[model samples]
Target: MKNILQVVHFPQGAVEDIRFIKSTNMPYAATGDLFISCNTSDIDANNGGYLIARLDKNFLNGIPTSLSWFNVVWAKGYAKAVHPWDVTNQGEVYYVSGESHGYDWSAMYCLNSQGKRRPVSNWRTHWLKNGTEWKGTPASANPFGQIDSVNYSGIVFKITGRCELRSWNMADFSSVQSDGNGGTRKGKWPADFLFNSPCDPQNPSANSPGYTGYSPEACCPVWGLAVLQLIEGIIMYTWE
Candidate 1:
């Protein structure tokens, strides 16, 4: 990893989780790069946000270049996605649920690269950009881009947990088959998520370098996964 990629921040905050997102459009559809989808932690002026990390090479080359940044999302609530849509630009993320953030609880926000959030009339109705702006779920809701000729649809499974996979449609943010399939149900998935990216570190007091930020949790610096991508699909780790 290059020095630039070593330790980076999300504006005036720290990073919570990191995932490499790929592209989903035409020419770059078949080719995907390793981009960082970082969840931000409150620190000083920075509260919550999601920033994309960039590099000269799609993947990482230990001793070559550094890392840069791309589009970002800002919100005081936990603005995190279930999957990395860095370049894909299509997917949905679950937000600051008390179940996940311990104390904070807010509405689930779904947005696009332009930073425009999916407008929902409560939780049962979503407004689209075109057509019926107050009817169905938009394509940007699906983290996997599209599924079976459909955009806001796919089945996701936990990496390591009690398997509970289901066909997800962004329409109402549920898997309960709406059209006799099953209708959205109580689907709560869990897994040991590993984040490998640079972030702000807290001192013994669990604050930023200058005690100028809010710690997401009592735990100061969040350190878990840190691996180097040697090949397109091969990953090498440096567990710190």
Candidate 2:
């Protein structure tokens, strides 16, 4: 008789609701792992940061048996729309868009493939935005895709949403930005790690020059509206 597959139950945060879940493929593991995120109450309020957790991918259903799978607490607060993306050679890195730190304090964050959270103190390469909360499109899925214009597998965080699109070199995880100011870019549009973008990715109409229309690869045909606000996510981040 074939064993019936059972859905494994993972731990949850206090009064948190599951928003999104992704089957993550880790570097060290042969099989993919499970990644889940939850929102507090609703979109209007940012009272709760996105609660995130990761569970091992293993399923078995033969008779009634309790099993505890190894779970990793990925992020705590300000981790709405948790996404794990790879820039071809960039290795695997996760992007955490700040949804609500304290009243919708929107910002973007990055984490390496080793499941290691980069220190926030190094805001230069880790955090983006001029301490300005455009709250444009809160990145979900850590929701974004690769930039089509770039020759190498580059990233286009929010093709349409213009607070600022965050990209980095896979070789060194170096930050790249869309020169909203029209400054001459290097071979790869190399700019400051964390600075204001001339393109303004935090805004909805922020298409930038090299791109056209919303990112079909990122958000599957986003309607011309506040799409990011509709999605609920966990606020996983380091507390100050």
Backbone clashes in each candidate structure, one number apiece? 11, 27
lDDT of 2 by residue, 1-240 (tens): 488555444355443665665544335544354445555443434444444444333332132233222112222233434422221122223344433223323434334344444333313222222232212222211122212211111122323343223332333223344456876332233322322333323333432223222222332222111112111223222221
- Residues 150-231 of candidate 1: C-alpha lDDT, one tens digit per residue: 3122111111111112112223222223334564322121111121111111111121221223222443222222222223
Model 1 lDDT, full chain set: 0.32
RMSD of each: 16.3, 13.9
Prediction 2 TM-score vs. true: 0.34
